[model samples]
Target chain A: MIDGGYQGKILRVNLTDHVVKEEALREDWAKRYIGGRGYGTRIICDEVDPKVDPLAPENKVVIATGPLDGTTAPSSGRVMVITKGPLNGTIACSNAGGYFGPMLKRTGYDMIILEGKSSEPVYLWINKGKVEFRDAKHLWGKLVNESDQLMREETHLEAETMEIGPAGEKMSMIANVMFNGHRASGRTGVGAVVGSKNLKGIVVRGNLGVTVADHDKFAEAVRATREILAQNPVASGGLPLYGTAVLVNIINSTGSMPVRNAQDAYLPEADKISGETLRTRNLVRNEGCSDCSIACGRVTAIKEGKYKGEHGGGPEWESIWSLGAMCGNSDLDAVTMANYLCDRYGLDTISAGSTVACAMELYEKGYMPAKDAPFPLRFGDADAVVESIRAMGEQKDEFGRLLAQGSYRLAEHYGHPELSMSVKKQEFPAYDPRGIKGIGLEYATSNRGACHVRGYTIAAEILSPGLDRLAYEGKAAVTKFLQDLTAALDSTGTCLFTTFGLQAKDLAQLYSAATGFDCDDKEFLKIGERIWNMEKLFNLKSGLTGKDDTLPPRILNEPIPSGPSKGEIEELDKMLGEYYSLRGWGKDSVPTKDRLKDLGLEDLS
Target chain B: MKVLVLEPAKCTGCRACMDACSFEKSGVFNPLDSRVNVITFHEDLMFVPTVCSQCETPYCAQVCPTAALVRNTTTGLVDFLKEKCIGCKQCIVACPWGSIRINHLGKEIIKCDHCSGDPACVKVCKAEALTYVEVEDVVASKQQGVAQTYRRIAAEMVKGVNP
Candidate 1:
């Protein structure tokens, strides 16, 4: 336990043998990994064989909470679900902000590792020490919400559940495991890994509270983090007020918002799904994930006709842009509805929308016909966006099956892979990297394909928090620094939002206080660097090359059609060299001997 | 009549109250064991918080076979008298809110005693959903909120706002 916090035991569930084991967490691994995404990625990379098929039962699914979880730590409600991704064919680690992370820790486990496929559909239930696997045949065909309701009814009362939908069961390459009230461990096809194991969901309830190593010290450290957040206008003010949807208009204004399938970097109708619109129209309430004072999770509603009586979850900035502008659809209700459908179907809305947007481009260029597709699928058709989301979930029709595989493959199937926007096999998030040069390099170098959370360079390039690297000249250095810092934060089990309010050193203090390790500040940054390198090493071992570290053709070649960033295509090669130089990598992008030695990884190979 | 003054609209569903109650009573984050509880009854993604409404002429205290509960003379708040109390769970059966709980109590009836006036539930409420208010003022604001919602709908309809 953190001197006075929760015990550091990982609960391992072997579905193949119906065994629940509690393994002691390795302190060294914990020190290096931190928690949540960092810890989860490390575990999956170390335990699961790289050669294993993404959809095979041999791949292990790891879920973990970070160190700051279950405490009074601000925005520490995020949980990470790590696995081999069928979408990118590499390490897939996804995270979502919700109550589940702290709930899992309070449920008396620092992590939950699911291994081996069950012969039949099964859902694991944990109530403190009592654990059991029940036949989930009845829950098999149900949607995420229905599964949760049924599980709660069967369990004799309220239950916190994580359940996959039909997309997951179908092993859709872009599926997700949805939690209560629509929180999700989305993207990178982690749900497919769970689906491959015939695992439906996990239900948990616990009676434990965190105990930090040193109470006064932890309290002091935690207070410092709060102080940092208190000063950060973005976290304490902007996020808590508008949620992430605040980024819609801001990014659009800055020409960073992706529009018309990343071909354009801005859309005029972006205000339709902007945070201002959400506040005036859709927002019902603000909810937080576990331990988060900054309740960024919004409970939204579509109050009018068509999408009325349909609500909950959010059309957050990414979802708003990805489902709205990227698809060439600017209808607010349609964006909200599409997001709702993705959540219910337990699919990654970003990938699902990107996939549909790619399909629309294909259709426009005569790659696929409107009649052959399930709906009158067009770029700006809001109805088509909603229908296609359903089609992806059902996975019955031919095009639906292809769309479920995500954008990269969907475009490849239609003979226009160049039209798809992704780095490494995964679809892109909201930003059009052509506008923000550093972000393009960040996307390319991300271990888990195209992902914004890998390194939120927008903080520097767009927000210009401390230093601005808007141009490509010094972007590589900043990208590497931010990635290392983000990697450290991700591992520390702290919220990225906390960074807006606090610093890396503050987070380090929390870790040291909570764990009673007397962690040096310099060592904390080193921890993040070590975690990033280890994941890179894992991907490298799995046959990824420096060539895989490149953006889509759309990003590299096409000029952004409009906005302040017009005529700019990402200058990736120039930044790549600088990024490599700073990261202590050779020309080939492999970790150098000094780098490996720095992270104490000389014995790892 | 001590009833939980609830503002569902204000509830963030953070469950800080859950931990506060458990920490004081059970020394853990045991929702099952905590005397005071909160639930997020979601409809249209709305968070509805439910807690013990210590009733007047209390159904639970009135029905208890043992004199396990008594009202405070000044606060007029219903409270658990652990002394001269047995773990018969009669109060648990009689309470309408399902707020009365035995919670593994061996020989004492457990209930919210308002933490001697500074209700722990109120102090730590992240959403400010609950308050141990004075009896007469407990419900006026909730009625105002409901009326406001309807007024908003009526106004919006007249404005001819399009979907």
Candidate 2:
């Protein structure tokens, strides 16, 4: 029997058969892989076959929370969704924050695994230990927020719901699952997989309370962490005031903000859409997730104009880069509107915006005629960006259909794959690698595709203020450590922003106090390393090789036209060799047998 | 003597206050057990804290047949005696704010008592949204807020601007 921390139940549901059952959580797995993304990746790797289509019945979607979820620990209201990515055909693990994670954990379950496709639309109602299958045919094809509201009204319970909008129902490769109507488990098309199962949403409500292993010790650790966060400039001052968009000006100042579809590393109009501008022009207030002390979530509003009274969660730094700089649109109002549409329609903004950017480049290059689009699409046209996003979400036109295929396909459709600034078919975020060496290597090797959150070594390479932003040496080791630590942190059911002030040691203490396990910083990092290796194994089994661990041609070959790091191309080959060695992998980037044995993952690779 | 006053504009909707209250009374971390509830209007971008205002004439106390609810003289808060409660749930319906709730065992009513003048929720609120302040000071501060807003609006009008 599980003692504390974990709720000790793993719920499995087969939508095809409408069969639901619970399996005892494996404590050994908890000790080895921890939870959240770690547990989700491991479970999905074991159950889903490498050859199965991500949108097929064989594909499994596992949603897992860690032992620290539902506790008093800061930012513990988060969950991980793991499945085969329909976008890039890679092992995908997406994390989202809101109330859904804690509410799920309070139902006495560590994870919920959904398998098989249903013949018709359905929704799952989970109350404590019982799981009910409710018909959602009427709720099908609704917007994410409308679906959430309808589900709550039908259930007559104050339940936390995660729903996918028409984008997912149409199976757009970049469609995401919206949590609590706003937060998204965005990236890799996890929502498309759920949509393929004909499951519209999952509603959960629980009253059971979580009890910590050592209450006093947990309290002390939590108290100390809050104080530490309060002292950190990024966690307290910057994040609370500007949210994640705080990085817009800083990264731009460092000449690392990717602009105009990677044509430039510096956007001259950056200040027009920067976080400071948002604070004065759009932000209504700062919001937070469950138990979060650092309220970094921004609730914004478009005060006046064509989009007056329009409001939503945010246009984060990535959104600003994608919808603003990347598309050559400097209008914050248009960016904010696009962000809200993406959220409501369950679309991944990075992919959607990058696809539009790619289309813009194609149109400018005369490959795709401007007349073919529903509107006159051009760079710096905020109206075009807004209309294009709406058209894509609705799949209304030929241009919309092409753009829905994401940047890789959209760029290739016009015979210019190089225009798509992506790795492994997933769009790159705001950071330009020419100015940040660690981020480039991290992007190349990230199992889930080109993603900043996977291994945000930029935290040290750029945002640290005093550290070397362009150093290639020792970056391999640092990126490897960060990738592993990020994997561990993602599994802990806490927001990664906590790393700004608290390190692995602090997390270890909190986890130990909550779970009654004495894990140290070194051990925690080792667990993280093991989880990363496990994901690597899954990717390898799915036919990805070391050669796949490379950046896009444009990013690797082109030098920054003009920036602080002008004339610098990514030195990827120099770091990839060192990274492989540091990770204890062969030159082919496959984990060695001995390395697998050490991590108790002998049967993995 | 003081009462819990809420400035909802400053709330982040973190729910730390609920956790603190739940831990104080139930010895566990659960929002369902917390007396103070936070409701968020996502579309409007607002957060409102729901707690007993401790009205001069508490409807919960007046509606009670067995007199289970009574005003505590020291804290100037309504206190519930579970032993005297009949579980009729009149207090639940009578509370306009829906602040009172049934305990986990469903045998008694749970409501805020200001934690005997040192509310756990107020103590944990880092945003200073929930403050324990004197009643007169609360009224004066609200008046000051209105005056400040009026002055800002007048200044904006003088400058030929509208927000």
Q: Tell me, by DockQ, which candidate is best.
A: 2
* DockQ computed for model 1 against the true two-chain complex using alpha carbons: 0.32
Q: What's the lDDT for all of these models?
A: 0.78, 0.87
Q: Model 2 off-target regions past 4 Å?
A: A369-372, B65-67, B143-163
Cα-based RMSD of candidate 2:
2.2
Q: Model 1: how far is A47 from its true place, Å?
A: 2.1
Per residue, candidate 2 scores C-alpha lDDT tens digits across A1-605 of 55578888899999999999899888888888878899888898889997689999999999889888887788888888899989988999998988889889878788999999999999999986689999999988788878988888887446888899988988888899888889899999888999999999998988778877888888898889888888888888888888888888888888888777888888877889988999999998888888888888889999988999888899888887899999999999999999889888899999889888888888888988767877777888999889888888898778777787799988888888888888889998889888898899988999999998888888888767644767888789889988988888888898999998889999999988888877999999999999999999988988899988888787888999987778878979989999999899999999999998998889787
lDDT of 1 by residue, B30-49 (tens): 44556666566644555566
How do the predictions measure up, each by TM-score? Answer: 0.91, 0.96
lDDT of 1 by residue, A483-504 (tens): 8888877765667777765666
Q: In candidate 2 chain A, where is summed lDDT lowest over 10 consecutive residues?
A: A462-471
Q: How much does each candidate deviate at the interface, measured as C-alpha RMSD after superposition?
A: 3.2, 1.5
